[model samples]
Target: MMGTIQNRDKFLNQIASRFNRPRISSPIGKPNWKSQPQYEVYKGATQDELLEILKEQCKKIHTNFVTTDLKDLPVVVNDVVIDFGGGPIVTWKDERFSQWGLDSLMKQEWPEQNIDVFEWDYTVGNENIHKAEHANVGITISEITLAESGTVVLLSDQDKGRTVSFLPATSIMLIPKSTIVPRMTQAAVKLREIHQRTGHVASCINFITGPSNSADIELNLVVGVHGPVKVTYIVINDL
Candidate 1:
């Protein structure tokens, strides 16, 4: 849940009293930096250009990248599921799936194909995690796409469980072209804007770069040791 300090002033006042200084409750203005290089990378690049950068980064990260329009998203997603050894799939309970014409694909069509589909339900609690653990694939949509690092940001909420992206053997992230940004700098600014406007942001903001990789064991690079073994990103061009 989105939350704020219940007794912020009281808590700070107690700390100030111990320090022997008066509490300064007013907000401080941000200092101007001498150099703001964060905005310089891929500056002024169009969405298409950003997509190209993301594609290149995907190769380096060992992530499969595919581009499609809204018209073919369902087909592309279905194909990816099949390619990854068709589910038993788990996905967040996000409305966009229905909004983008994927409701039937998840709810009806996949089941018809004898593919078990599980949507995270907060009311069901731990059952969600169990389903994700056993699912062949987990699918989710990106809230923010980093073109430079080929990362996708996921904001956790009641309906969007983190396990949907973490537990499954294969993971699929749906990216809308419009959500693609140059890098982390742009993504951070967007997040700040959201917090400034709403006074709160998601409790957990995940910056997932491809799938989980680790070299902790004898310096040999291993993939999917801690997360999904295979990762595929489907970028919707006309979303």
Candidate 2:
């Protein structure tokens, strides 16, 4: 902070002098990467097969996977709710979930306990919803699921807060089976295309594979140590 304009120039000059170089007065251009990849990242399966692979990989990593038709989403939600134990349920606002007819499903005859479901609309334009971080279950919509890694891609915006996936004890992701890609490379390429075509860049794009965990505590595995203890994926085939 104490350095002046002259001092900054002097420091650069000192380094240039040490290297026996001189400063050039010219504008620098951006670095150019290769136009094509040297080797391809193989996407070796069809959508159906990729979905199967994603489910298998998820099981191997201790992440739960559930396949249900759009009509049965509510039933699956209830099952997840039961296992999540009970605090509160937070879900997306008027997003694709509503488009796929999941509005009534969220409220379809659950236990008569005090558990409440907080749809994203409740917080719109100043709804003052509190204890959001304490919600037991957090549900989100993911457009892409990489089969090779069993990861779900979430594009964050004003409506889709990043906290929805990271703050709760259990996180549930709803992914359309049609969007299941065989590899991460295909997903990345699509994201890049979207950015280029629309000139719109999301603040955060999260690739979630499973629950937040760590094994650094004496090499002993710990779940939810960093964030949610459990992660579940509900892949919709009929969506």
- The Cα local distance difference test for each model comes to 0.92, 0.77
The window of 10 residues in a row where model 1 has the poorest summed lDDT is: 220-229
Model 2 agreement with the true structure over 121-237: per-residue lDDT tens digits: 534644413445778888888867788888899887677777778877789898889888867778887799879998988779998888987888799987778557898899998
Highest TM-score scorer = 1
Count residue pairs with overlapping backbones in model 1.
Answer: 0
Show model 1 residue runs off by greater than 4 Å.
Answer: 1-29, 197-199
User: How would you encode candidate 1's per-residue C-alpha lDDT over 1-239 as one tens digit per residue?
Assistant: 99776988788899999999998878999999999999999999999899999999999999999999888889999999999999999999988999889998998899999999998999998999999999999998898999999999998989999988989999999998999999999999989987899897897899999988998889998887866989999999863
TM-score of 2: 0.77
Candidate number with greatest lDDT: 1
Instruction: Give candidate 1's TM-score.
Output: 0.88
Per-prediction RMSD in angstroms? 3.3, 4.9
The CA root-mean-square deviation of candidate 1, after full C-alpha superposition on the true structure, stands at 3.3
> Which residue pairs show collisions in model 1?
none
Query: TM-scores of the models, in the given order?
Result: 0.88, 0.77
